[model samples]
Target: MKKNIESIFKAHLEPKEVYKGGKNIPPSDKKIYKLSSNENPLGASPKAVAAMKAALEHIDIYPDQTDMRLREALVKDFDGKLSAEQFLCGNSGSEIIDIILRAFINEGDEVIYSNPCFLPYSVFSRWYGAKTIDIPLLSPNYDLDVEGILNAITEHTKIIFLTSPNNPTGTYIPKSLLDDFLERVPKNILIVFDEVYRHFADAEDYVTALPYVLAGHNVLGLNSFSKTYGLAGQRIGYAYTTPTIANYIRLIQKPFLLPLTSIEAAIGALNDSEFIEKTVQTVLDGRKYLAQAFDNIGIKYWPSQANFFIIDPPLPEMEFTDRMMEEGIMVRPVSQFGAPGKVRITIGNQEANEACVKALLKIKS
Candidate 1:
């Protein structure tokens, strides 16, 4: 009798939905403005590009398994608030989430997060056979419902994922609410704060989870080089937590998680303060310009502290997306994010922003 491979790996073979991201635009003759993914308007830092070129000469040599050089750069970048030992670098913020899940989650355990969050949290949890609890965000503003999250907690709850300046919605949890929530959360449960868009946030009350991690709480602050550093192509990110948690993650992660070019690029990007400043300022300025344009055009959009904002278009969500594509502009329709009838638009450079606005104006007319 032939053995059934599907039956043999039944647990792993279970049909689960894969996560989807922004739509990609194929090569074309027309000028395409890809404002779909929330990427930096400015390209990669020149210093980082130079470093990546230099690293190519030594591509034959293996990278340091411990990622000591990159960690040291992070230490200086954060002004010693976190030590080298407290950081764990990974391929990207998404991979760091997977690593944490692998390190702690067990079959049938529970994970809690807001509905319409970064889709990977639920996708990854289900892959590990963890039951994901989706707590609904308060409507109108899309702020996290802390009380709802607290009420959903059970003994089986292992991890709680929180995204500040959250994707699609572009809303952040205020410090006051987070502090209160932290005090009430059980010490046994781990809190993962996804702050990949931190650099773009300028809210006075907005703060990263570093303070909680520094206070010895079971918290991890996840950051990425993708947005602010404009190193999305390099696929590198990091997480900072207590030494105990960092050490635990280090145990399960494979050696040389990143290539030399990526590490060197991140380090070089860190050293380029001028480029970083320009990127942030440009995003902020473009955000304001877009907001004013939307208001003038009589379109409703949520205020955003991150690099992107969600807009309720005059047409259907997918219809709006298709229309934008026809105009050589790619925007994301976030119905899968539990945000039906809404479209997410990245704040691009001046020219790109103008092009997007012009396309929207044409659609409206």
Candidate 2:
């Protein structure tokens, strides 16, 4: 008889809850308004669907193991000017995050991330036996403190993941501050810029960390088809960086992680310029409308440049989130994100946005 198998997972396994956006319902119900996950309220790009459909018959063939089509589509903005070697495609922006961590982190190595930022980065850092350095955001806006970040770096520090228009808070790093940080950071430390919400940014000079990649610095920019292209179901995401670094990550990732149809769909989404434009407009309009609603209702919200904003409710964040869920309107509670009294509300479609406001007003009353 075999003895009980020992748990292989290391000691630092601080389990994170797998989030389900809303209550699962039978197909009989017509609609459920979900504003929990920061997903595109407008669904997948129509052209992406057409492209995926076109590739349906070719299921027998495996996807390009190297993810050529997806990479090519991402760099199309450069007139094919950017080399294809500088990209790595994988199962979601989340997987790419995993790949980078797997490639760079090791025992005793250090991984740094902003607090109340995307949860996965911190979660995986612990998973890989690296020490997780959680940095708290400074006042008014939860901004990345350049000086504090620089001070945290040590010889053991291998990576820093910064989320622009950071999750939950939605406050972005200023151009001048980012530029200053880049200049001061050591060349050895690779910076991972999670630009998943970059497309939602409204500021003109809102500096994204992409230029760090283009400038041949130790930086890589992560993007996903989930939010902007509305392909979360397809699970395609990518990293853009200098050829050498990108190739390193690509080499570390498992082959064929991205499905052929997903790559094809991404290509289609990119080509359909109008759908992408419409998605952008929808998010912008919805966010503006929600901001006005929040203002009129006297609910304080942090300045957001993304598809979601941080609601600083007078009641506890967990209470607010639970109350909204009871109303059949799901929103995210950042109380678990190490922040109390704050909830992240995604900017949804017209109906969803209106319903959420109505729920909030009712709860307030």
Candidate 3:
């Protein structure tokens, strides 16, 4: 029985420490510029705030079980014939990923992703007893190695996770490149394009991968309101896929995991066009400022089309992240994302942009 307990619990444990932000420390009472996570430095939209406050009245009731209103709103907003059946509302982008893994992935199936992609792609793959196969992204730009990923597929391949303006790297796979790759990958494999950062991408040819879905391709486009919507605290995100896959995702998900306030907040967030436009402008402006500063400091970083930038400071990545924390600024070290010598910084407000640059300059790196 003791052996059986160990067996069940041990099968899905992460082999490495996943450094989620806000853990491993106490909450700082004074507001420190938090650029570690790619959150909108501007707080959530007023529209979302009002909705959440209104939802406070309904706390006694068990909230909407299926979040039908939110799903219906999404159907109309996408402008396509996106049925409510094609939508799966999860607690966060993370939960949506978890559901996808559970809904798919037979034992020993292969999950392919780029090295330096989002850590959860590997984490949750292991959680479901699926083998993880990581391929390295192209050098300097960190674009997806489309040819390499296409070649890596095997009969056992069950999933491929791609992040546009990828986390940590903040680089996107070109639409044409991805369109070609989608046409090549086997239909049996479910490919997920995690476009959580989609809102920040200013690239003209950026593909949402929705066309593939509309054409009945086996694809799942993952998105979350956490970034551009400034609703990270609300834990609201959604997945759009084929009706079959979406229904299967709904079946394994726990009942009412997404609360009333989160659902209401997400729905309200979608309507605030001005806030989103301003958020995009702020991040783009900050990106320009930070990129210029990074060049001046002789620190290596990439100019991004997304809301964050990746930098290789002159010192060890871990030491750089730690030193900045002491100076009341925190940046994420990309070592966890398989980029050992780099750091990923969110494009914060102007003040944070200045402070981060100053902190970087003060350090030896």
| Number of the top-ranking candidate, with TM-score as the measure | 1
- lDDT of each prediction vs. the true structure? 0.92, 0.83, 0.85
Q: Please, what is the TM-score per model?
A: 0.98, 0.93, 0.93
TM-score ranking, high to low: 1, 3, 2
Model 1's number of clashes is 0
Per-residue C-alpha lDDT of model 3 across residues 55-130, encoded as one tens digit per residue: 9999989988776788898897797578999988888889889889988887789999998878889888888788
Residue 114 displacement (Å), model 1: 0.8
The TM-score that candidate 2 achieves is 0.93
Mark the regions of model 1 whose C-alpha exceeds 4 Å error after superposition: 10-13
- Model 2 over residues 76-136: C-alpha lDDT tens digits? 9546756788888888888888889889988789988878777777777877888889878
lDDT (10s digit) by residue, model 1, range 1-365: 88776766648437876788666778899999999999889989999999999999999999877688999999999999999999999998899999999999999899998877788998998888898999979998998999899999999999999999898788999999999999999999999999999898999999999999989999999999999999988999998999999998899989887999999999999999999999999999999999999999989999999998899999999899989989988999887787888999999999999999999999999
Better of 1 and 2 by TM-score: 1
